[model samples]
Target: MSRGFKKFSKNSYKFFLLIYKTYKLTKKFHEFDRIFKKLYNLLNFVVFSVFLGVGYGKYCIK
Candidate 1:
């Protein structure tokens, strides 16, 4: 009985550890996703402004 109880406890501990690690990984992924989105938006804005400037210059030249 004691051995069985020990085995059960060990399994539960391992299960909980796996869950905790998965949670941490998900949290880190979400943070990285947010940062990537922000950088993507900034890049899009820069590209848009550059294109607008080029278009305006061409229009003026023409």
Candidate 2:
């Protein structure tokens, strides 16, 4: 009975550790995703502004 209790405790400790590690990884991924989204938006805005400027230049020249 004592042996079984020791094994159970060990397994529970490992399970909790696994859960904690997974939570930390997910948190990091969320942070990376937020930063990536911001960078993507900034890139899109830059591209859009460049195209708008080119189009306006063409209109003015014509």
Worst 10 residues of 1 by lDDT: 1-10
| lDDT, residue 47, model 1 | 56
How well does candidate 1 score on lDDT at residue 37?
57
Q: Model 2 — which ten-residue stretch has the worst lDDT?
A: 1-10
Task: List all candidate RMSDs to the true structure.
Answer: 22.9, 22.9
| Model 2 Cα lDDT, one tens digit per residue, 17-51 | 57556755776677766665577568557756876
Clashing residue pairs for model 1: none
Q: Please, what is the whole-model Cα lDDT of each candidate in the order they appear? A: 0.66, 0.66
Model 2 ranges off by over 4 Å: 1-28
- Residue range 1-62, candidate 1, lDDT tens digits: 44765577578657755755675577667776666557756855775687678778888987
Clashing pairs in 2: none
